[model samples]
Target chain A: DAGVTQSPTHLIKTRGQQVTLRCSPISGHKSVSWYQQVLGQGPQFIFQYYEKEERGRGNFPDRFSARQFPNYSSELNVNALLLGDSALYLCASSLSTGEGYTFGSGTRLTVV
Target chain B: ELKVEQNPLFLSMQEGKNYTIYCNYSTTSDRLYWYRQDPGKSLESLFVLLSNGAVKQEGRLMASLDTKARLSTLHITAAVHDLSATYFCAVSWATSYGKLTFGQGTILTVHP
Candidate 1:
């Protein structure tokens, strides 16, 4: 079976621009979450969605947002990107809220 | 707020040596997870520790959880070059089981 898959493995954007990263969860998974991993640091939680509802959000600023689709796929959007926004965006999916998660290869975003 | 921390941000071990990575969290958690990430890659789930005194082993790696101490450990035995990677520990609280707060990661390098 396929694991979580993310689109556009790499992306480059300019400051003040916006970018949208997509994720397709594994089959039979109903929960999707987003995380940001800066170079030399561990991943940080961003947002989690279950049953297409926003279940939880992290300490990220309002510029970051995400939503899950009926199919359990998810999209992460970041507006007004800054140089600090250059990092790997990871998407994880699980069969339930507290179950083990499967992560995608992630989208490496670079903001200039 | 839940905070996770890992010591020895970097680990350099010789092949066939054994070592352990420690993860400490500040608040109560419903589950603990261990993940491995290769350079420029996403996370690979290694172990899921659900309860206090839970221990799981796969191949040369073992993970143990001590919820009473709010701590978890990942032990690696007979390390090999292929086992070199960054390891992360994440914790999810009962209130928001879908959101995982991760540690700072430990980068392990095994040399012959």
Candidate 2:
């Protein structure tokens, strides 16, 4: 079975620009979550969606937003990117919030 | 608000050595997860502990959770070069739909 898949393996953006990262969860999965991993640190939760509804959000600023589509795919959008926003954006999916999650090969975003 | 902290943020071990990494969280959680991530790669799920005293092992790694203490430990036995990577521990609340709070990863380097 295909695991979670993310688009644009790598990207470069200038400060103040906006970017969107996409993720397709594994087949049959209905829960998707987004995380941001800065260099030399662990991933921090951004948002989570279940059944195409916003289920939970982390402590991230309003500039970070996400949504899940009817198909269970997810999009993470970051606006007014700062150099600090350069990091690996990971997507994780699970059959449900009660189960273990599988992570996607994250999209590397470099905000210059 | 929840917070996770990992100790020995950096670890260097000789092949065949044994070591343990600790994860402590500031809030109650329903699940604890251990993940491994290679440089420039996404997370690889290792173990998920769902309850107090829950213990799960995979190959040379074992993870145990103590919910009362809000602590989890990942024990590495007979470490090898292939086991070298950054290990992270994350926790999620039952009502949050799997919104994870991750620890500062422990970078493990198993050398010969």
**Candidate 1 lDDT by residue in tens digits, B1-112:** 6689997799999999999999999988889999999998889999999999999999999999999999999999999999999999999888897898899999999999
Interface RMSD of each: 0.5, 0.8
DockQ of each: 0.94, 0.86
List ranges where model 2 is wrong by over 4 Å.
none
Candidate 2, residues B1-112, lDDT tens digits: the string is: 5789998899999999999999999988999999999999999999989989999998999999999999999999999999999999988887786688889999999999
Clashes of each: 0, 0
| Candidate 1 chain B: worst-modelled 10 consecutive residues by lDDT | B1-10
Best by TM-score: 1
Could you tell me the TM-score of chain A in candidate 2? 0.98
Q: Would you give me the overall lDDT of model 1? A: 0.94
Q: Report how far residue B91 has shifted in candidate 1, in Å.
A: 0.7
Deviating ranges (above 4 Å) for candidate 1: none
Q: How would you encode candidate 1's per-residue C-alpha lDDT over A3-55 as one tens digit per residue? A: 99998999999999999999999999999999999999989889999999999
Task: Tell me the docking grade of candidate 1.
Answer: high
What's the TM for model 1? 0.98
Clashes of 2: 0
